[model samples]
Target chain A: MTETAGTYGTEFFVRWLEAVAEAVEREADRLTELDAAIGDADHGANLRRGFTAVRKALEEEPPTAPGAVLVAAGKQLISTVGGASGPLYGTLLRRAGKALGDDPQVTRERFAGALGEGVEAVSRLGGAAPGDKTMLDALGPGVEGLKVSFSAGRDRAGEGAAGTVPLRARKGRASYLGERSAGHEDPGAASSALLFAALAATARAEAADGTRTDGEGAA
Target chain B: MSAGRDDDGRGGGGMSAGRVGIVLVSHSAGVAAAVAELARGLAGGGDTAPVRPAGGTPGGGLGTSAELIAEAARAVDGGAGVALLVDLGSAVLTVKALLAEGGELPEGARLVDAPFVEGAVAAVVTASAGAGLDEVAAAASEAYTYRKE
Candidate 1:
């Protein structure tokens, strides 16, 4: 579906969040598998627990703004999950939320900018540049691809996710493995790509369906 | 969310009154529990806002992914909203995916990117003290910006 800017509605945003949760749940094992090869095998488990907690908390109290929801989720990640991932991922969302401000409706450009902020936060937190083989490997390219594709009127979130393969790990637990981390796609990066891909797909679908209003053409 | 009373009353009312909730996403239940505990402790005698944890199911396997997030989206009461905190890159993506799958989340569910340790503490403090979700999110975002500091 072709998603126009600002076409995303509340339902679209919720679905995007759910898609992220599902992607992480589905890949938690793979993440643990990758971590087992280098760092602790708990990456998957750690992430799983964190997301579960987020869901529970949300159930008890729902939010009113997309930015608010993201910020709360990020904080939960940090407090509940340990290690580098907790802080890195937490920063990504918090920064993204802040970039979005108090706007009730998010435009495509705003979403993109917020996500870009998230990517920047991850990179800064991990101290890794592009090609470092960490989540940044996937996130860096994924975000850039999104900007390009979205700017060009195409949604390439899925394509950006697929591009994470072949990168080496340069930071976080996987970095300890050095070249060994290469060849094997970074699990974190793969997941990051999945997140963006889902967002792109959902937004595109929502926009095409005319579910969005105010910011529909803003992208 | 409960508000803490400011002795000086500079906050206007003696009781802190704002709207905000904190969401924690982690790979380890223990870690999430620990953070939640810390947040409660930090709240001290003040009215503690809600701290929700989304992670590992007790029996193993991925319990609730997107559905869980949607559930969380429905929890908060005040007009402030909720802030999400995650543990890893995958966790971040997973939460986002859950949102996508769920379709159209409740209002005020912003994702904050901050050092989990610092962010959690800041969020709890702000939330418990009557800061709304937007204010708390802003505070958490600032925590991330100065994480290294």
Candidate 2:
């Protein structure tokens, strides 16, 4: 199993972004419903537009390297999302892509580490730590889960997102709602969980197909 | 990124050496433009620094765009540098994300988190007076101390 780590190929990345877009589309209204309680109620629409642009950008100038793919997607989201999530998620993918270096493919471990960096970048940019009722709640644990087990990471992400329902908002606009923010799922955390879920599903597909090469020597 | 590279050509030094470029970021496009106008008015309109407004989404929604702000930063950034004044937390985050992309902001650029209108007014006025990057940034920061009890 260790010898068959999934490769972060351009195809995988493209699929990952598309899956995220699909998941966001599937849950857009739910996301907006959650946000309506604590935020501007635009998270769903914002991400829908952002990921659509990300897909369009990839189609416009498809890149071979995984980093380039993510960079382009990140750039599109930064330009189109039009909210705090725009910068937050944009920084996540952009910083993660940068951390991935110029490699055309990467191992699951390496990809997870780069993703952790991306999540950390969000923490730095928003100054929100774990349990802040922000995306970090899910993203932080999801990164850890990835380090442990891809499947476990996915489960942890779901749990982490659900866990936000009881935490009071401490950052972003939701914080302005005070204690009222409790009981409502954090829209950012929910979206982040969906992103991880997409990644996990993609990884599952690769593992089943035996296409998960551990990047033995390419570095 | 290239902000430093273009810092020496646009507004060469003098009493009004390229007014330190000012980018106003807000969730409301109209608010941002209005603030720019108000700041220009405060600057007395004569040889004032460049003030660009980057507010709302491209479609006129209430939000901010990193690309738009970066474009504004580039447009107004002459030789001196650019100072960004944001209206909300997200605005600051967008600027930070734009910088992390490793492609915007002049060498001496700054993101000043001051009260929107006051900071814009003070920063541009200082820029119009031939003040350098730090000086104008200081003026913007001083607006934070402005109390209208």
Predicted candidate 2 versus true structure: per-residue lDDT over B65-89, tens digit per residue? 8777877887777767789999986
DockQ of model 2 vs. true complex: 0.77
**Which parts of model 1 have CA positions greater than 4 angstroms off?**
A1-5, A148-166, A204-219, B1-149
Taking all chains together, each candidate's TM-score versus the true structure is: 0.54, 0.92
Candidate 1, RMSD to the unseen true structure: 11.4
lDDT (10s digit) by residue, model 1, range A34-87: 667766677787777677766765556666667767777776675455445665
Local error of candidate 1 at B145, Å? 29
Which has the greatest TM-score? 2
